[model samples]
Target chain A: MSTVVVLAPIIVANWPVITAVVGAAVGSLGFAVVRGEETSQQRGETTTREEIEIDNSEILTSDTGFEEEIVVQREGVRAIFSRDARGVLRVCMEGRGTSHAELRRWGQELIDRVTQQYAYHRIVTELKARNMTIVDEQVEEDHTVKIRVRSW
Target chain B: MAKEELEIEISPSGKVTARTLGVKGPRCLELADLLARIVGREESRTLTHEYYETERQVTDQVDLYGHR
Candidate 1:
């Protein structure tokens, strides 16, 4: 062993990349995407919904031509991820009969998953770019991903 | 020369912990720094005993052999 370092992931990416990671995160958490066209209908049906923003996360988008939002639902709870005016990614949760605390927890979980996926993607891409080889990779029971890489 | 190895673990909450295996001296920090830049800011770092041992070995080798 030589050195050990701990890092806190910072997500700074374009729209498409962020969207793809968001999709993967949602899927991994058992959330199904609520299509753009059907989100309005879904929103209308949830009468007692609540919205909460996830803390300490922002996805920067270069394009300003259009606003894009990704909505996903799991067990009748909906999570909406969109970039605010400041280019800060915002996640809002909506669900009927769900307490505010529950919504917040779900929103945080989604953000956590997104951050993990983003970090994984960045690490793998960088390693490949540097001509490094991943010798082993695995996901632990706690959902933590371990990767071993070698370079001559 | 032995191959340099890096062991990286990304927790469920996305915090990353990386360790350099078989990499000696200051070169280990270089590898860790590269990863820090790729992932994000470094929260904390620990240099194991192995880190200093290599530097001491190099100094001893220099003392015995003189400048090449």
Candidate 2:
């Protein structure tokens, strides 16, 4: 080994790419994507809602004048992901019977998964663009992803 | 042709640690920079002993060739 580097991933992507990562994250966490109208209807029944803002994340879009949001539901808990006016990503979790703590935990989990998926996607895409081939890839018990790539 | 290898480990929290293997001198940093751009800002960087060893070998080779 020659050089080692540690990086903290900052999520910056277009709306469609952000949606894709959010979809992958929610799917892995056993959450199903719900239509915006369906989520709006479900919100009427929710009693408690907690919002968590993810730091170091931004949604880059040419048309930032419009708002976009994605909602996912699992086990009666709903998470709505959206970008604030400043483009920072936020998730609001709500459920009728779920405690605020539970909602917060679920929101945290979702954001963590989103960040991981975004980083993995960016790394793989950039590496492939540079003509590098992934020789091995594995996920550890702790959910850390290890990838070995080679360039000749 | 020589093969350059990079081992990247992304933690669950989305922090990335990348180590370049079998790459000599400053060339290893190029790979690390590429990853930094893809992921985010680099938190820290460390050059292993092998980096210096390779630099020494290259300098020695240059000296030997110049002496000839």
Candidate 3:
């Protein structure tokens, strides 16, 4: 390594990526998205279908001034997405039915995925703005990204 | 050929690590600095054997060109 550096990621929340990750996380845990109309219609229906649901509108709110919270539910895990006063997006996993360690793992995984996507886009955009040619880029299996660029 | 190259790795946790290739001498740090600014704030930096080796090559080239 000619030079090695460590840095704290500057969080510029990419709302699209966050929304996608929320869908992914919920899907991976065997939850289905419930649209507002469907949720209301199914209130009295006896259904055997598994329905771990989240409101799509709440996840895609355009308002960025105040805090927004979206809750995604699984069988026993509740994933909460909220923005703090400082504009920091947070993912919290909580439920009394599951192990605390398991919830923490899920929460951390969501955070890592969001941060990785945000950094990837930010770095690529900045590199282009600086007129550097991106030689190659790849996302590793560990969810890390490697980019090689050439600059005169 | 553009003899300056930068490789950056961003960890899942949002930490960034960058290295310079094909750049010699103090120029290595200069390239790194540019990349660091683009990526994020630098937490720590370590210069490798390649860095020192490139520095020596730059010095040799300067001496050769200067004398001629």
Candidate 4:
């Protein structure tokens, strides 16, 4: 008798096991559920613009409410998140630069730059063994010095 | 399942660093190579216990003393 060896595709293994597997995946990634299910920081503040766009100009809180903002008032680098009218998560980085595009570009960049300073980014740094640039120049924004990246 | 995680950061100065985790073997090097190709700066890397290790650490290259 002969035995056969096979290399199967590594999937979530599909449902009715899907829900359980998703839960496991979420838990592994250090996430908890509030409403009905799984994981991580989503950049949305489900509120009116008037509520989020206050004079302070801060971004809306994360879905899990585990959110943060770092602003260098003296050096002019600011990162903020908020939920727009459409209820999408938005991360906007503000800083001073020569042109509008330049400021926006730098704003997006500074977010990634400052992030690596934190503990989480530290793991990412150790894992990657190289720098990760979150903001690419492909997206264009108004010359407001605010680089806004959105997520669903 | 490819649970790969990557991170890169630059300080107030132009100093930059990169890291990857959960990616077994030299596959992580692909990510490092991509960043080096783009950032164009001579960056240094540190291998951690998350995925791999190095007999020697690549330090002393960055201006570590000037951490402001």
Choose the strongest candidate by lDDT: 2
Off by over 4 Å in 2: A40-43, A63-67, B61-68
Candidate 2 - CAPRI tier? high
- What clash pairs does model 2 have? none
Against the hidden reference, what TM-scores do the models get? 0.90, 0.91, 0.65, 0.25
User: Taking the tens digit of each residue's C-alpha lDDT, what string does model 4 give over A12-37?
Assistant: 11122222322332232233223322
Q: Calculate DockQ per candidate and list them.
A: 0.88, 0.86, 0.54, 0.02
State which candidate, 2 or 4, has the greater TM-score.
2
Best by DockQ: 1
Candidate 1: which stretches are off by over 4 Å? A40-43, A46-56, A64-67, B61-68
Error of 3 at B12 (Å): 2.7
> Candidate 4 residues B1-68, lDDT tens each?
55455433333222344555455555566655654543433435544453343211323324454564
Higher-scoring candidate on lDDT, 2 or 3: 2
Per-residue lDDT value at B45 in model 2? 98
How much lDDT does each candidate structure score? 0.85, 0.88, 0.63, 0.33
Second chain TM-score, each model: 0.84, 0.80, 0.64, 0.58
Candidate 3: residue A33 lDDT (0-100): 38
- The lowest-lDDT stretch of 10 consecutive residues in candidate 3 chain A is A49-58
- Fraction of the reference Cα-Cα interface contacts (below 8 Å) that each candidate reproduces: 0.95, 0.94, 0.78, 0.01
Pairs that collide, model 3: none
- What's the distance in Å from true for residue B41, model 3? 3.7
lDDT of 2 by residue, B1-68 (tens): 78899999988878899999988888887888888889998999999987787789989999999999
Can you rank all candidates by TM-score, best first?
2, 1, 3, 4
Model number with the top TM-score: 2
